[model samples]
Target chain A: MVKKEKDASTEQRILDAAKQVFVSKGMAGARMQDIADGAGINKAMLHYYFRSKEQLFEIIFRDSIGRFVPKVKALITSELSLYEKIEQFCDGYISMALENPYIPMFVLNELHKQPDAFVRKMFNNELPDLSKLVQQIDEEIKKGNIKPISPVQLIMNMMSLCVFPFLAKPIFSILMGLDELQFRNSIEQRKKAVPQFIMDSIKR
Target chain B: MVKKEKDASTEQRILDAAKQVFVSKGMAGARMQDIADGAGINKAMLHYYFRSKEQLFEIIFRDSIGRFVPKVKALITSELSLYEKIEQFCDGYISMALENPYIPMFVLNELHKQPDAFVRKMFNNELPDLSKLVQQIDEEIKKGNIKPISPVQLIMNMMSLCVFPFLAKPIFSILMGLDELQFRNSIEQRKKAVPQFIMDSIKR
Candidate 1:
């Protein structure tokens, strides 16, 4: 049991180190050696664990795609009203994005690079089932709670408002002439602002 | 004059081919040999026109950043009312993004890869002068044309709605169960939808 726990801990350490290296350097620039060094393990141990950089990258990529939209499916299907669900979703997602700013760009760029991998992952994994959300939207629209618009587009708009600020931080910061802290604070403001913006646009 | 004209044509051909290659493959994946082949020029002639791949990339990168926000400064300084300016800007920007869907991802990802290059380009190049735009927003707010909100946030929200869909296309497409044509159509729907969404949120 002790040995098994030690193995699991070591694997977790390697994963944590690999994520840091991958996030900073990207797939093209990242090296196995650097990941090993970051993990405080020898190259041989790294190889013994992951076999190849490609294997390691695939693991990370899958994990990233999976983690990017956690709780959205649950939140959408929850007992909350449409407005409450959207508020929670926007708030939760923006906060999550602030903590993991690299995930959006990293996942999207890698998807562009390797569509086949992403396609396979998508097929294998259970992504957010949007049909329920669509039904909810229909119910809300019928009940005159919100405007009639495509739920997909509405969700896309909300996600865009919440996430795009982080993805395009450099350009937005430069254009707005904001320093790092200022830019971060601006994004923090969007947690509330985005939900309100969406609700204003859609609410009846 | 014939010699100069021929040289100009050759350089233009090389640049066109290089843009195609670079836009598709990105800077790291691109090769001078492939670019030369695409241009139907020998490597020697490719070298004659551009000193190196790096030089070629810099030229394209600079041109891209400059072209991304062309006419923003001009539009802001134009005699149009704030509502008209925003309506035109949102319409024009969304249309442009739909046509050149790769621009947002390419610019933002490259900015992540090489901040120094992007910073120098942004500073040296004629990016949108936002001071005037902010002033215009203030004038409009005083006149009660739009609700009081940070001009920077308003601009960010506009851009986020227009561009983030393209940047996160892969994820959005998969999660929304949209194929390429469907995704493209949804984006087309947004050209009108986004402006209306913004107006609904901000307009008095």
Candidate 2:
């Protein structure tokens, strides 16, 4: 049991190092030597544990997507009102992204290279059905609580409002002439403001 | 002059081919040989024109950002009402991005790799001042025309709602079980609906 635990720790160390490097450099640019160096392990050990870079990347990508999906799913599945759910989603999505800002870019970048494989894996594994959230939007529309809009459009609007800030941070900061502190504070402010904005638009 | 025209066409071809390869593979993954093949030019000609992959990528990145910034600046500098500006921004941003869907992800992914460099280049070029938009938001708030919200937060929300859908297209398509037709329609719908949503929330 002690030996097994030690093996797991070493594997995790390799994964953490690979995640950092892969997220920054991506698949084709990342080298086995660099991952080995980052993990404080020898090249032979890296191959022994993961066998290949592709395998290691797949593991990390899966784990990253898995981490993001549940929080998003929680927002969709919650019993909160449509307004409350929008708030929860905006807050939760941004916070989750803040913790791992690189993951979205990493996933999207890799998927651009291997769309069929990544899309299949994502659908087969991580994403939850948003039909419930869609149903909620429809109900709201029917009740005349919100303007007439498709569930997909409404959900996409809510998501775009929440995620684009982080995705466009570089452009936003440069265009606005904000430094790191100001940029972060601006994001923090959005935590409350985005939900309210969404609620205002949709709530009758 | 004839020789100069030939040189210009060659440079244009390389840039166009490089944009396609770079946007798909990113900087780290793209190879000189691949770019040469894409451009239907020999590797020596590619070297003669651009010298290196980095040079080629810089040209593409600068051009892509330039294309986006002008429209954004126009929206900012316009004399339209706050609500009208949001509508125009949604229309302009989405249309530009759809015409070049790869650009937002390409700029964003590269920015993650070298944020300081991206910021410097972005700011060295023309960009819009948000003071006008900020003043508009402040006026709206003072009159209680909309909920009191920071203009920065409002901008972030507007961007998030507008941009995230394109950035997360694969994940969204998977989660929503949307076929390509449905997904395309959804985007088209948001081009109209997003502005209305933002207007509904903020209009008195």
Candidate 3:
């Protein structure tokens, strides 16, 4: 059991290192040697654990999705009122994006390269099922608590408003003439403002 | 004059081909040879037209900015009401993104690599001056035509909602269970829906 625990820890260390290298260099440009160097492991050990770069990348990509989707599921499934859910989701998602700014781009870039495989893998495994949330939105509309809007579009709006600013951070910062601190402040502002915007649009 | 016109035509041909290659392959993966072949020109002529792949890419990127921003300026500055502007902007931006589906990723990837240079160039050359739009928004707020909101935030929301689905097309499509036609239809839905959502949020 002790040996197994140590092996698991080492595997996680390798994964963490692989993520950094892969996110920066992308799949086509990433090298196993660099990942091994980042993890302070030898290439042979990397091969022993993951077999190949493609396998390692798949693991890393799945791990990335794991980090993002569970939080979404938790927030959407929680018993918070719809307004509160949007607020919490906006704050949580924006904070998450800020912390791991590269993951979205990494996922999107790989998806562009291998659309069928990545999309199937994500849909089958990591993308959260939002059926409950969709049903809840329908219920709310029926209750006359909110305006009629497609739940999918509403979710997409929340996501785009939360994520795209961070995704386009480099260009957006310069376009707005904002320094790093100001850019972050703008995001902080969105945490409250986005939910308010959505509530304003929806509340009957 | 005839010699100059021929040179200009060759230059344009090289640019058009380079945009195609660079947009599809990205900067790290694109080759001058591929671009030359696409243009139906020899490598020597390609070099004569644009000194290096880097120089050629910058031009292409700048040209891309040219295509998107002028339309933005035109829409924002036109004699349309604010509601009409939002509708037109959503329609125009989505159509532009569909037509050049790869440009956003190309621009974002290059911006990731050369943030300072790209940001400076965009700010200095291509970013539309939106002071008039901002003033109009403020005026609308003062006159109580819409709820009080920061013009910058409004612009950001409009951009995020309009651009992000296209930018994250592959993942979004799979996540939403949208095939190509369905995805296009969702965007078509947004042309009216987005402006209505915005109006609902802001209209007094």
Candidate 4:
């Protein structure tokens, strides 16, 4: 047998397989044996690269958080008006989620399971500083650009609108009897509709 | 040992234990033995009552859907204005969720796992008709009672705002560094704030 054990492609293949397994089954349900099978490697080899499932998840989660948090930081920190920010954020975030459909569930399920360790590791670098957004919202309220709403509440509202559908997509689709194409169409409409909904609610 | 089998209390006990096991571990990870232990019954007793985990989940799910869906149907079908409907929905739904925090995760997780069967059983009676709400929304738009918006979009928006908080509560609390009291307080404030937020956006 060819022993291409230490190669970059082999490592990438393992990561790809781990991402799929973790995304589908979540941390509690995932099995290392399944990951090894998905990666087409022996369990010994899977362990050789990553000591355990937790470690593998940490690496994958770090990669996901890195990509997700920075964009949010940039969106909030940019010198756009609150309305403009809402529009751009909804568009960017939804599009990002569409492209990487598994990330939200993967991060959230694990984060809920292990909040303290997950949050600490995710925010270790302090990349997406929320306080900056808070201050910006405060300035907007002071300037009469928007109605007085709690910055945290506004953040929560915006996030919940943009992300919840994806998080609960499978259930909503089945419950509402929406076929795949129809569900996607609603989301497509939401890119514009969500921003409008938020703006109308908050604009002075 | 005196056999006290096929009793009503024993059935209720098994049900309660099943709900807890299913909520925490989800269907894939839940075990029959755990439910038996939780109910303080032997495995044979549990099986004698429930036949299988799938059957147990079906019964529990039917009970959950019964309690939850009717309230929503009433909220929509009541002789209330759109504004009143939105207000009642946000307040009632939030309060319901706060009291039974486990149900959202329980239902959504199971529904996603088995979409077809779950939805079929949940709506077997053809309950909580969405069309009634959709018709009401159309009438409100015609009467200039609110801004023109798709009924489905509005329902999605309101639902996303109210329920996502509970669904993502544990993760949000940790991510935003909210303590228990703080999270509870936010939800408390949300009962009013969400309604106002929705009203402001759509009110003509």
Worst 10 residues of 4 chain A by lDDT: A1-10
What is the lDDT, from 0 to 100, of the residue B179 in candidate 3? Answer: 90
Question: Residue A92: error of model 4 in Å?
Answer: 2.1
Model 2 spans > 4 angstroms off: A1-14, A31-45, A67-88, A125-127, A174-192, B1-15, B39-45, B74-80, B125-128, B173-185
Q: Which residue runs does candidate 1 get wrong by more than 4 Å?
A: A1-21, A31-51, A56-70, A119-124, B1-21, B31-51, B55-68
**A128-195 per-residue lDDT for model 2 (tens digits):** 66778788888888988888877777777777776777767777887678898898888777788777
lDDT of 1 by residue, A1-204 (tens): 144764457677788888887766677767788888888887887777788888988787667656645566678777787788888988988877787777766666677776656655644656666777778889999998888899888989888898888778877777678899999889898888888888888886
Worst 10 residues of 4 chain B by lDDT: B119-128
Model 1 scores a C-alpha lDDT of 0.78
Candidates' chain B TM-scores in the order shown: 0.74, 0.83, 0.73, 0.80
Evaluate model 4: give its TM-score: 0.80
Instruction: Indicate the worst ten consecutive residues by lDDT in candidate 3 chain A.
Output: A1-10
Candidate 2's fnat? 0.85
**Predicted complex 3: CAPRI docking category:** acceptable
After superposition, the stretches of candidate 4 with alpha carbons farther than 4 Å from their true spots are: A1-21, A30-63, A125-127, B1-25, B29-65, B124-127
How well is each residue in B51-130 modelled by candidate 2, as lDDT tens digits?
A: 78788887777777677777777788788888888888988888888777778778777777777776667656444688
Report the lDDT tens digits of candidate 4 across residue range A1-204: 355656657678889999888877777778889998998988888778888877998888887667767677788888887778889999988887777777877766655555667666666746366677789889989999889999879989999999888878876675567898998898889899999999899889
Which residue pairs does candidate 2 place in steric collision?
Answer: A160-B160, A160-B161, A161-B160, A161-B161
Candidate 1 structure quality by residue, lDDT tens digits, B105-180: 6677677776656755655665567777789888878888778888888999888888888877877877777898
Better of 2 and 3 by DockQ: 2
lDDT of each: 0.78, 0.78, 0.80, 0.81
Q: Alpha-carbon interface RMSD of model 4?
A: 2.2
